[model samples]
Target: MTYFILQFLNGLQIGAIYALVALGYTMVYGIIKLINFAHGEIMMTAAYFIYFFMTLLDLPYFLAVILAIVFSVVLGVLIERIAYRRLRNASRLSALITAIAVSLFLQTLYAILFTPDPRAFPLTASSFPVLEIGEITLSSWTLITIVVAVIVMILLQLFVTRHKAGKAMLVVSEDLKGAYLMGIKVDRIVSMTFAIGSALAAIAAALYIVSYPQITPYMGALPGIKAFIAAVLGGIGLIPGAMLGGFLLGLVETMTRAYIPSSVAQLSEGIVFVILILVLLLKPAGLLGKSEREKV
Candidate 1:
């Protein structure tokens, strides 16, 4: 039972990361109806930027994180302007293909520049502290990750609910045409959404590197895919739903790994796919998603 509890905590920590990344996917999709498949690469680029700053410039960790996030935000805005803006009126297939091409281009760039080798982030002394409660043991890093994730989520909720820009984002997401009709500056809102989401992904990447230490060009691929799945499972375009989906998926994955046989442990991902199919079959719009009604 203690082991189970510990595993649950671990799962929650991982879920928090997924939730952060998933938010990027959901928010972009919500506002622009674009999947932004290159989001993971944006995250990877941010991580690499931080690493370069730390190694080449000898910057502090916190400063590196901030700069990385800012860099990612700028990159996101640029991509939206240069790539997505052109395709806004084009077919959805065109936007999707462009996104995929961008994703591959970034991945290839990283592989060429970073050698596809796993690089270790500079680990501070605080990286590996352990904590114990009763019979359960947990890492300090895990606790920190969960706390940070919660705080970020709260800030995001508050922004979306209370801030003017955030309200604009909500309006755009709910009805882009209506928002445009209301003089909402739809293009600016979409750019802001991408910037905010990419910034979150950068933070998630930094935290992930803190926990795992070793990172490669492809490190973001699996996590990004899983986070996208979580967004879909929870209901794309719903912020709270994305969070719940990420945590639930994390718990399910962890539990499956813990209790299932070793031979079948490899199939945990498959299990998640099965669950996704079931969810889609039962609720095509997702757990918290509302059905879209077409105008006759």
Candidate 2:
């Protein structure tokens, strides 16, 4: 029981990271309906930017974070403007292929520039490094990650539902044509979505490397894919649903590793897909997603 509780807590931490990345996936999907497969590369690029700012220039952590986020936001907006904007009315396949191309381009570009080698990322530990409750131990990073994820999700929800820009985003997501007809700047809204989503991924990348400190050009690929799964599992276009899916997926992965046989423990990643399949079969719209009626 003690072991189980420990694993569960760890899972929550992992889920929090997934929630951050998954929120990006859901947000972009909600607006404009593109998956932005290149998002992971955006995060990767931010990580490198942070690293460069910290090491090469020896800047303060706070400044480095801000600059890294700015760089990521600019890159995201540029990708939308340069690669995806024109394809808005084209087939989904075109957008998908473009996203893939963007992903490969970044991966290769960074690999060539940075040599594809994994670099060590430095992280500061919490003031209270460990928390103990009757035999279960939790690290500060684990606790912080969960708390941050929750706070970020709450803020995001408020931004979407209450803020003026948020309403514009919702309007655009609901009906781009209607939003345009209503005098809302649909292009700006879409750009804002990409920028915000990319910035969130940068934050996630920062939190993620603390747990797994190795940084590489391809680092964001796995987390990005997992987060995409999480978004789908939680109902792709729903904000709260993304959070729920991330936490649930985290619990599933952690629990599976703890209980499954050691020899096949590697299959834990595969199990997430199995859960996804089941969810699709049972509720195609996702756990919190509602079915939408489209004109034929």
Candidate 3:
């Protein structure tokens, strides 16, 4: 039981990071109906920004984080304006392919510039003090991660329901033409969505480095994919769903590794995909998602 509780707590920490990233994925999708596959790459770029600010420029840690997040926000907006804007009226296939192209471009560009080797992240778990409770021991980073995620979730909910700009986002998400007709400045709202989402990704990248510490050009791929799965599992367009999905995915992965046979433990990743498949087959609309029909 003690062992189980430890794993559960560990899972919550992992889930918090996943939830942050998944929120970005879902937010972008909710507003623009685009998957923004480059989101993981955006996160990777932010991580690199932190590396450059800290290692190369010798800036303070919190300062580096703020600047990195700002840069990520700008990068996201630029991508939307340059890459995805024109494709708004195009077929979904076109937008999807462009998103994939953008993702590849970022990865390749990073690889060429930074090399394919992994570098040690400056701010790691060792940087934090550990906290022990009874027989269970955990890092301060774990508590911080969970607290941050919960705070973010609450703030996001409030923003969406109460803030004027957030209400504009909701309107645009529901009916773009209608919102525009009502003078909502749909383009601005879309950019805001990307900016907000990218900021969340930056935060996730910072938190993730503390746990994993290894930074590579391709570091964001696995986590990005998992977060996307989480978004889909929780209902891609629903904020609460993303949080739920992230926590569920994290628990499932941790528990599988802990309880499953050692020989087959390597299949834990595959089991995640299986969960995605099951979610799709069993509840295509997702746990918190409502089904909608469109006239074609």
Candidate 4:
């Protein structure tokens, strides 16, 4: 029971990270209809920024975190402006290729500057006091992560449903042309989407380092991919769907690794892919997604 509880906590922590990244994927896809494949690289860049600020600049942890997030937001905006904006009216294939190119460019740049070696970041003490519940012990960090994720989700929900800017974003997502005609600044909204997504990725990266300090240029790829999968599983353009998908994916993956045989564990990724395919075939719009019917 204790072991089970521990694994559950671990899954929750990982799910929190996935939710953060997946939200980025879902949001961008919702408004722009682009995957933003380079998003993982944005996360990698943020992690590296945190590393540099903490180790080289010797900044305090909070300051480093803030700076890293700021840098990531700027980078995301620049990527959208330089690569995506130009391709806005272009074919989806062209935009996808651009996204892939951006991903490759960032990876290459990081490799050159940070080297291919995995560097470990400094882990500060866990944020929460440990609590013992019968045979199960829960760490403060895990609780904090879950709580924070929930709070963020609530705030985001309110923003989208109630806030003017968020409603504008929704309008843009629903009908870009109509929204533009209605005096909504489509470009600014799209940029805001990128900024928010990147900021979330930064937060995820920072929290991830707390548990797993090792940082590498390619580290973001797997998590980013998984988060993308989560977005799809939950209903790609839906914000709440992304969060639900992330936690479910995390829980499923962690449980499989814990109980399944080592051979099966090795094939867990493949299983996830299969699940993704099945989900697509069964419900193209995803679990919570609504199918957008085209009007002639």
Candidate 5:
């Protein structure tokens, strides 16, 4: 029972990080209908920014986080304006290829700059207090991560539901032409969406690095892929669904890792895709997504 509880807490901690990154995936898909494969690269970029800020500049943690967020937001907007905006009306395949190109570009740039060497993350490497519940123990950072994930999700929900800019986003998401007809600034809103998503990725990168403490150019790829899967599981465009999917994916992956045979433990990540396949077969619209009937 204690072991089970500990695993559950671990799942939640990992899931929170997934939730943060998944939200970025969902939001971008919601607004632009583009996958933005480079989204993960942006997270990787943010992690590098944090690493430099902390290691070279010796800035405070919070300040480093803020700077990373700023850089990510700017980079996201730039990517949208330069790479994706012109291709919005083009074939989906075209946009997808471009996204891949952008991702490779970032990866190559980082490889040249950082040389693919994994550097230790300074924060969360030192000893921190651990919390004990019954016989189960949890890291303080894990608890902080869970709380932070919940708070960020709640704030995001409120922003989308209650704020004026958010409503404009909703309108644009529902119908781009309708939003333009209704006098909403479609382009600006799209840019805002990218900025917001990128900022969230930045935050996710920060939280994730603390737990894993190892940074490299390719670090964000797996998490980014998993987060995209989570978003799809929960309904790609739905904010609440992204959160739910993230947590669920985290729990499932953790459980698989703990319970699977040692010889096959290396295949834990593969199980996630298997689960995705089952979910898609059972619920084509996703757990939270609605099925649409195309007009013939």
Candidate 6:
């Protein structure tokens, strides 16, 4: 029972990180029909910014996080304006290829500038306190991860449902032409969506690095892919669905690794994809997503 509880907490921690990243994925997809494959690269860029701000500039952790998030928001908006805006009227395939290209470009640029070497993150698991209750032990990181994710989710829900700018985003998502005709700045709303998503990714980047305590130019790739899968599993465009999917994926992956023999524990990742396949086959619209027919 103690072991089970321990793994559950671990799952929540991992899920929290995935949820944060998936929120950005879902928000961008909800607003624009694009997948934004470079979104993960934005997270990577933010992590690098944090690394440099703390290591080179000797800034405080909280200040470094704020700066990194701001930089990432700018980067996301720039990517939308420079790479995606022109392709808005273009074919989906063209936009997809461009997203891939942008992701590759960022990866290459980071590799060149920072080198491909993995560096130790300034913070480590030991940096946080651990608590014990009877036979169960809890890490401060775990509590912080789950708490922060929940708070962010609540705040985002309020923003979407209560704020005027957020309402404009909904209008733009539902009908771009109608939004434009209604005097809503569609472009600005889209940029704002990217900005918000990038900020979430930046926060996730900080938490993830602190947990894993390692950094590399391509560090965001796998986690980013998994988060995208989580978004899809939860119904890609639904905010709550993204959170649910992340938690499910994290729990499943953690349990699989925990129970499976060490020799085949590597199969945990493959199992995650298998679960996704099963879910999609059973519910094509996703767990919480409703199916919609496209106009001919």
Q: Write the per-residue lDDT of candidate 1 for residues 1-296, one digit (tens) a residue.
A: 89899889888988998999999999999998989899988888888988988999999988999999999999989988989999999999999999998888889889998899999889632567878889877778888888999899999999999999999999999999999999999988998999999999999988888877777888878788888889989999999988998888888888898889898777876877887788889887888998788787
State the lDDT of candidate 3 residue by residue for 30-118, as single tens digits. Answer: 87888889999989999999988999999987899899999999999999999999999999999999999999999999999999999
- In candidate 2, position 171 carries an lDDT of 92
Q: If scored against the real structure, what TM-score would every candidate get?
A: 0.96, 0.96, 0.98, 0.95, 0.98, 0.97
> Per-residue lDDT for 20-91 in model 4, tens only?
999999999999999999999899999999999999999987899899999999999999999999999999
- Candidate 5 TM-score, C-alpha based: 0.98
lDDT for model 4 comes to: 0.89
Candidate 5 stretches greater than 4 Å from native: none
Off by over 4 Å in 4: 124-129
Whichever of 3 and 4 has more lDDT, that candidate is: 3
Estimate, for each residue in 1-296, the C-alpha lDDT of model 5 and write its tens digit.
88888899889988998999999889889888999899999999999999999999999988999999999999999999999999999999999999999999999899999999999998882356888877777788888888988998899999999999998988888888889999999999999999999999999998899999999999988898999999999998888898999999999999999989999887886988997898889996789999889656
What is the lDDT of every predicted structure here?
0.89, 0.89, 0.91, 0.89, 0.91, 0.89
**Candidate 4 deviation (Cα RMSD):** 1.6
Model 1 segments beyond 4 Å from truth?
124-126
* Number of clashes recorded per candidate: 0, 0, 0, 0, 0, 0
Candidate 1 achieves a global lDDT of: 0.89
TM-score of 2: 0.96
State the weakest 10-residue window (summed lDDT) of model 3: 263-272
Question: Model 6, stretches more than 4 Å misplaced?
Answer: none
Better of 2 and 5 by lDDT: 5
